[model samples]
Target chain A: MSRQPRASGYFRTSYQADRALVATRLERAMLVLFVVLLLAFPLFASAFLLDLACQVFLASIGALSLMLLTGYAGQISLGHAGLLAAGAYSVGILFREVNAPFWITLPVAALVGALLGLMFGLPSLRLRGLYLAVSTLALHFVVVHAGAEYETRRGYSTGVIIDPPQIAGLAISDPRAWYVILLAAAAGTLLLCLNLLRSRTGRAFGAINTHETVAAALGIDVARGKLLAFVVSSSLTSLAGALFAYYRGFVSVEAFSLFLTIQYAAMIIIGGLGSLLGALLGAFFVTIFPYLIEWALAALPGAQRRASEFFAVNYAAFGAVMILFLVFEPAGLVGIWRRVQSYFLLWPFRHRPLTGARK
Target chain B: MADLELRRLCLRFGGLSVLEDVSFAVNAGELFALIGPNGAGKTSVLNCVSGLYHGEGAILFRDVEIGGYRPHAVARLGIARTFQHGELFAQMSVLDNLLTGRHARIRTNALAEMFGLPGVRREEARHREAVERIIEFVELERYRHAPVAGLAFGTQKIVGFARALALEPTLIMLDEPSAGLNRDEREDLARFILRIKHELGITMIWIEHDMQMVSDLADRIHVLDYGRTLAEGPAAAVLRDERVIAAYLGRAHARPAAGAAGGGAPGGR
Candidate 1:
């Protein structure tokens, strides 16, 4: 009798069962064990390893935001760096001009990002695909140039110095403190995104992404949904941008380049298009990737003579790895993870019964 | 009073007129058929009614003027339509596609829904039950979780129809539901359409080329040619209208009209 229900794995028999995110006991145990590992990391990790983990956490915020916009909402954007720059600059300008605190500057930056997102998203109502991307790219240049213009006019040609953000009685300059703080922020963002993807908002995004006309016919406001995607994604990205500014204790137009935007985009794509876990996995992959390449290059023969070419070699290796992923694993890391997970989960039973497909 | 009415509806795409002064009324609980050869603006009429096109003149759904409403606004007023080519979410499972039809009715906010709060969970389960009923109604049990994109063309149409039904629409507009269907599928579609009309008392505005099914099911027929209405009346009368006959076959290659052409009810009630 229960064969039809569980067909292959666990079956959802009630509303709660179907709605549960971590349905299985095994999944819950794995999650608890993972949390334990995350908590214990700071105790044993090397300084370099700790810093890399922090960077990956920070990148996950931007990556998740982009995945929400481009992946779920199906809007192409090439202006992500511009939004981040706009955020960082808002902090730079506010702190320099009015001596604003972190509390004041973060919201201001988010507002700037929202306004920029609106500006970036305007072309989307009329343009799609490459044209939309091109317009965003143009706007990115406009935003970056504005930041550069400010730097020159203010005579801070190199960059603007920012004091490490402090609470009423605490200076959070320790890498461990920063790591803990960033971990919370990244976790909060993940929770928020997971909330969005499961709700009516996610459905609207999915609808508009899949087929705008049909979504509209179903009573979804497609234009509004598209704009909201840009606004929300950009705001989160800007918040991350502001945090990055504070973390480095400096704000420079150079840091928010097109390359930074490409790295974030690569995180989402090489991670997986539509999964949040893919965003995190992608951040880890892309963040560690360059170091991995550098390590390999050093281990190879003639390493001493070619030390100057390490940066160049890193770029070539990164590009080659990206192309390999694109050609061979276009579904990104999550797809590979899923295939492996299924292989083990359904061991000895190669194919799922037709009715046993994932919901 | 009609469930839906189009009064002097005119639609133009820049220089070309798609629908010109096309007026028709569909009575509540009636299966009204709109028939014409290619380019008769049959789909345009559906588009106008669904608010995809902002045509000049008025579209009243349940006595409210909806001509200026956006697509979603019109949908909120309980009018649902299937596309000429199935416009299903290609990436979503058939179940998700149908659940989207209930978007306006799903009552949970983002936080509660994401956390799987009890109220939202209950609502989702209830709607899923409703969707499953329609799934069974359409006999799509086998393809329940299949993405609609890779399904056979005819099966896609069934998914489209089922999605439209999941709306609990006041009136459902079907565009070429029988077009790509095999004979058996077409027969099944006809039976479903009729059962919905009689049992559910839902209105239908059908655009179909399958004469046998249309003639058998339609209570009233409206014919169009070159974007203008040729005739509108009970099915048998409209089928025999001389202009309707000429519109199907140009005057240069015309045959004898329907009366001498030997179909029953020619020029009759």
Candidate 2:
């Protein structure tokens, strides 16, 4: 249950009230407004903006999953891109070989992701910190190599082409449809994460994250928690990857690179370490950042002459932004958002009194 | 059968023997104090019983041999412990920290919890009620919502104790629960200890350095010096034992000053 006192008029007298996601009338109104805006965005947005929103939604799924594994459960996994690739390939291989339907492929992709997650999580039992990260990195390389091998052996040199997923004879190729589908997936993932975090399983993850021995003494199976974190996070991540494959109509090892893993890691870090909201914000910022850079570069003087150098510039700029966030805003955008919220909440008084009734 | 028993527990860290053939038994609903000087393997015994250390001996809780079991396995058999350093989930609030103690009790699976099904919700509500009662018993209502890292040290220790109590275990192991508390807090802890024994009737194996509190609260006291049992008896008799006195106050104070050697007493080593 949330312990923070609300605005002066609201009071939570019961545990259910305290645990309710939306407590006040103002919050409920804001939520309604937010949902309305999200639903209406596709009707007014251009094709490019719709695609960008879809990408953000897709990235949010991966970022939230990563946040659950690395942020809450305290398991370091650099094999996220590998899990994604496994999901995409499961879809790619199943479709290319058997011409499977979307319904069959998605669950199969999740199962593949779960198996890979189990393999990736095994090292975590014997290792921690940097060593564990290295093991995951090695696994990522192995998965990517296998994907490359499949491409060569199958004679699909460039990549695997996945047909658009069809639901009830309707092809999900339109940007608006993709946007709505991805939005639902992202929202579902967020709700699932919230549910897990508020339950016994989530508390066990938090306790294991804080102290493994203490978690064990409290009757939490630390190894099982770690594996479950990996399996759950990996499955969600794979689902995102599968959606990404369907959205892009391609499954290629080139797209699931180490850089992609780093980008997802950056999303969690620049968003905020442990917060799910931070994951969403980070996904939006990271996905649209390159486009934002391109727009800014286009408006500068002599833009056409330096257009060829834009990729290098993007890389440099991205690194600089990540470093800045790490150095100056360690808590990420959520930290900044909280500061602003508290500033407005306590406008007249700079700080809450040290010895008052529930500051 | 004893609530907890350690048969010839021997623990060695590389070449250093921390606990050597230390045997003890704690009766049901008894407050058993394990006292020792620094590095006397007092904490090690708790670690062994809690399954943190793989000591060579039989650790039986309610006649079930749990010597080689993992910590979670040991806990599944109704054993819980509090660390000396307050190893609480620092980022979580006090209520959440205590709720983790209800992990074993909450039987809902991850899938059920993920969807937040009706059964899961009901189970959670039931556990929350029990945890609230524990918070009230520990007088931690004021700090219930506060993050554990932000609380004062003594309060954090209290939260750790409360977390252990939330397990509703048959046996609770406390490792220096009163180490850093002030006199007033220590007194309150001693009172709580007596209440936990008398009112709750839970068995305890407390490792503490505070002689006065231990003497007042402990039904039986087991003294350890250099990985060996120095004395074991009722609290009053154990405190008056010559060996226990020497272990605490040194050989010079244990005997007449004139007869004691000036240097290289066995207690000095």
Candidate 3:
């Protein structure tokens, strides 16, 4: 056994091999399979499932932005929902009042979101940790209250309605068509984020997060890096919000509540902080969980009527999952997955001496 | 003008005077050592020089008064420093941490970086080459991709030194570079210090407790006691002074045989 090659397929690497994301042909095939499954999801799933998937995609995008700021840059923000609301409301209002095209409205919304994020992030220079968190929380309330008032004062009888645009004379109003658009946007945002992470600015954010004092001593403008993180995070979140508004064809203050902020934070925590893959995984878990509970209740005898109670229970379950993960698995689901992968990868090696009888 | 000068530097923390009337000058290509017992304000002088603390006197670097400047602003003005306890970015890869040292030199604006403009990419590639050179110089190429937190203490110290070197500053201040290193690591650090002075041609102000290492590496030494400079001269002359011996050996141990009795090591306990 020692002389023979084991099934645990660990490959040695050259310099270039070490840098490759997927080290083996098998891993490359697995990635292809994953993409196929993602594309097939909307087709096979029910209407409720399609809606849930859209929510997951939207939340994933928002969480990705938060992960960049909190996980990589080490600056905690509790006002992300406000930024998202800023994007959604701005896009909704712009498209409704000015009759602007989606392409124009989208970039405008993102720019405004980034500006607001920078404004909120300015307080980070004077505060940090819990103090910064509190200041951002205040920002959330202020933005939400201001948004609520703005929506009321605008006096649009139907609120802001986002009609499907005639893109080259083809209307995109169908739910399936909107799903495809959202999926494309999510993929584009993810690719952009991935590229940023590999770039120098991403590394700077990580350095500032880890040790601002050392970063500054090393000639890094710590304050500027932090502000950039906030701006990027806000812009991404706003983009997601704008997509949400278009898909729903409406904008309301209720959609951007503090609970949504908590939900986004929970997604990042459970998926894994700092890891892009974790953001998507977290969004999946959070979005599907309530639907899963509803389905389970319907399946049980005489339990369908108690669906509202189950929804409440599901929220508590989400909070519990977050707390448990923070205490026991701070690396989140991605960390657990890596550990399991490594265990299988190192099988039959008996690296540790046997200290007890086999189970 | 001196490469770096601190004139009558005074620092107060609430009601306590941590540093008072402290003055020093480091010439170009000079290895100046600052020595003192615990709480004698050795690190305070470095903190003031590095702009980590507010001090009453002017800190002139290359004829520019840099007092009241922020740490990053001071660094941009060509002053680089290493913390007393290896303040490395734990989550960052060794190469990334080194690249951060070159941040002040990165002239690209945010818009350019975000857009991945041609000039920004070229400047980034140039900075990466410099960082790689520093990594090789410090013998940390093996751990170039590893996070600083995962590396050994000695390697982290070297990474800290590499980060300081990456700045290519006119003056470098190191606070206790050999604080937690073993004998072999200390010797390795000593060689690097000499290389930094001889090969790099950069002035350094180091606060160190290892007297023998100081005597071997430093061109001149400054002794501090109770926030005041008690002695300053060549390493050989400072080591032979009675007051220097008394400060390190204490008044009880400052006798004729004190040097021979193994009480000569600076910062004993």
Identify the leading candidate in terms of lDDT.
Answer: 2
- Native-interface RMSD of candidate 1: 4.7
**Candidate 3: deviation at residue A71, Å?**
1.4
Residue A131 accuracy (lDDT) in model 3: 93
Worst 10 residues of 2 chain A by lDDT: A350-359
Query: Which residue runs of candidate 2 sit more than 4 Å off their true CA positions?
Result: A1-5, A352-359, B250-269
What docking grade applies to model 1?
Answer: acceptable
Write model 3 residue lDDT over A1-359, tens digit each, in one string.
00111133565444334434456777789878988888888788888778777787788888888888887788999998888888888888788678888889889989987998899899998899999998988768877777677777888544577787668978788767777777777777776676566556776787787777777666677888889989998888888888888888888888888899998888889988878888888888888877776777778887867766886887777778889999998988877765555566456554521211100
**How much RMSD separates candidate 1 from the native structure?**
4.6
Error of 3 at A205 (Å): 2.1
Model 3 residue A272 distance off true place after TM-score fit, in angstroms: 1.7
User: Can you write out model 2's per-residue Cα lDDT over B169-226, one digit (the tens) per residue?
Assistant: 8899999999889888888788788889989999999998767677778899999999
RMSD of each candidate relative to the true structure: 4.6, 3.6, 5.0
Clash list (residue pairs), candidate 3:
none
lDDT of each: 0.83, 0.87, 0.79
Residue-level lDDT for A148 in candidate 1: 93
Considering every candidate listed, which one attains the maximal TM-score? 2
Clashes in model 2: which pairs?
none
Model 3 Cα displacement at A244 (Å)? 0.7
Candidate 3 chain B least-lDDT 10 residues: B260-269
